[model samples]
Target chain A: MRRTRPPSPTSAGPATREGRRTWGTRTAAPTAGIATFEAGGWRLEAVGYSLRPAAHTEPPMKTRAVLSAIGPDRPGLVAKITDFLLARGGNVEDSRMAVLGGDFAVILLFSVDSAGFETIMRDRERLAAETDLALVLRRTEARAPQDEARLLWQVKAVALDHPGIVHRLSEALAQRGINIVEFESHVAPAPVSGTPVFSMEAAISVPASVRAADLRAALARIGDEECVDIDVRPDA
Target chain B: MRRTRPPSPTSAGPATREGRRTWGTRTAAPTAGIATFEAGGWRLEAVGYSLRPAAHTEPPMKTRAVLSAIGPDRPGLVAKITDFLLARGGNVEDSRMAVLGGDFAVILLFSVDSAGFETIMRDRERLAAETDLALVLRRTEARAPQDEARLLWQVKAVALDHPGIVHRLSEALAQRGINIVEFESHVAPAPVSGTPVFSMEAAISVPASVRAADLRAALARIGDEECVDIDVRPDA
Candidate 1:
């Protein structure tokens, strides 16, 4: 669920007290040829009637990137990558790594100044060759604010190991214009029988127009056809 | 969200077709004096009615542990810790790490055989001493399956930077017997005013009896009192 918060004291009280909550729509004449207005949802008034040259400093405009690396498991693999990033002034913001089979796979979100990012782009090939990693890098931005009408939901499914489960399920959501935000899956043995069981979990965003009951019924139908146990509910 | 799935073909079909879904409830006499029953939600039958010595192989009864380490940032830190774990037959299951200020902080989930776990416990002190790290380790287990009626929800809040935001918010939740599963927060400059805005997001599990409307109203009151914008939604 996405909804704008009701006005809070720190943000809205002062303007409301002035009997005008609108920005840049004032009908009254400016007291000093300077109009009071809001920018980026923050109230701003020309500090002091006399304006001086603004501070020369600019806010840090950091650029972010997503990096995925998969390589043979070996000592110093993580060190190599992290060391390189540190040397380039890149800061890791978030990361997840795991060992699967005999290989190590990692995904990292990092930010760097623009020039440092350029350097990373130039040197990525050399580092990949040295580390023997299959590397994928893509520039990314912070997620935009969510639309207030979108609904978030979670879905979980379990079944005997089978193929096309993700494809079939995702296709239905895609047809309905739903977006999958995060998904994870694993295969494990049934505690007693040692038979492989597949399980999946995903977070999705449903448009405001979709009916939850209709979506649940659709998923129940798919559960019957695919022999899967599917559960869908609003995501916390 | 945690409801046990309705009967599916592969797991439930066989038993249902036999006209008895209840395990070990048959009244008829067994032809071979063997009682068939479900174990761990699986169907199993004695093979060939033979009682020969069963295979001696044991399923891997792996144990899990959580490790948290923080140390001065330097080259090869990850390598040093991971190399030690690999040498001890430990497998990295999940990991998250980042550099906060000038210190590298990491939390890892790993699994090992019981003996190997004991070995790690014994050597952890030496590792911490040698690496100049603050290390904490605790045994963990896979989360038990969720109860069917528990409600999973997500909460997010943004407010002018202030003390006690988390404390006050969580206190309300704790009073309601809600459990926090995951939480993260950060402070960043407001886009225009450069005011430090504190933002938080959390995933929580509410008891079955908690009404969603009541929870929302409670959060709304907190938002008003704390001068924060709070959004609560059923999580997907």
Candidate 2:
């Protein structure tokens, strides 16, 4: 049997509130199979079946996959998906979901034991048909650790809606061997003028050989050519 | 056969470059199926086989679906996906993709004629098996227009790592009937201390009945209780 440790008593840190009386308090005494904490009048109470201590042996190697699903937006979509995963001993490690247009679109990273993973994979087609969802799944392995020496930059651009803006910018970055980490874009009406404006935000990693000034200049040149306002800054 | 108009000559807008000569010139003459424009020393050139005229009959309604796929990171993943879609008379309307860890994960919004859509949907299983991708698909319909009166706000928070942070904040918003439009969260090391810190950015819609001041106060209270720095501002 694996023994579990009690929750740590250390305060996360001081609250930002001014003139507030500070007290590190645990309102609910932690019993076995339970843990709780409190600070600055707020409480975090959790109940767990087991919490492993350090130096635990490695358990079964689980399979990881990315799942994307879309269906009519409704209240029970998330609960239904999670329930299915939970029943199969799978856990969602990361996920994002939104109601896009009239549909709920979700993407999740999940892990499960071999048996559970196989079951999910084999049943996917039936799952899609039964759930009335369009589903996409991709098996994944551990990601390579990010290169620390690469400088990360946040790029933002706003311009009148037009074609090839993203292509032009991405081409420029690719020429410099910059790696794009995250990207998002949308079209919204401009304030006052109400003209449709395209806005994009991207996180890109610059190789050490590239000078920040040169990169900025290159982006400025593209902005000038495309009549877009582009801002480049170090990501926080 | 369909006829395409030459690309439009309208200038997107003026460039931000200072003291540059302003000339709206057509450097490349418009050919039968080509259109081009130049302003502030930048040019946009496009060639098309067919551009729909304003007074055209309704074409076949296209089926739209959201596709999510992940595969081992490589040079041709996107090209392969796009090629597959194009061969089926499909178009990718919007997409976001990133190399996460060692895997390339992508989500695309695409549309195809009914026959092509059916073909793609039927071939999904084979596609996954042959391509070695985890895939998720969701068919979608036109989304209802957004409510213009809903006040949009951007919320950002940063704090020490802890469970229940997101749950607590989301619960507060949910109680007030606020709808989250978009949300993203990530964990990164603090600059000086190297402590793992959690950061979140979200866009939410507030019902007109909810006062902005009250919302801010509620968020502040949660931040105070949780020892997190929260910022609420109107989204542009």
Question: Per-residue alpha-carbon lDDT of model 2 for B147-190, expressed as tens digits?
Answer: 64678889999887554466667767877777766666655578
Report how closely model 2 matches the true complex, as a DockQ value: 0.18
Candidate 1 per-residue C-alpha lDDT over A9-100 given as tens digits, one digit per residue, 9 for 90 to 100 = 34332244435344332233357755444333333343232312224634346777766666554434555676677677675555545443
> Which numbered prediction scores highest in DockQ against the true structure?
2
Model 1 interface RMSD over true interface Cα atoms: 14.6
True contacts kept of each: 0.00, 0.21
Q: How does model 1 fare in lDDT?
A: 0.62
State each model's C-alpha RMSD to the native: 16.1, 11.7
lDDT of 1 by residue, B1-236 (tens): 11222233343322344453443222233457544443334333433322221245343467767676655544345556666676676655545554433445555556677887899999999878876766766666555464657878999888886545665676677667776554545556789978767777777778888888889998999999989999999998
Q: Pick the candidate with the highest lDDT.
A: 2
* Candidate 2 Cα deviation (angstroms), residue A211: 7.3
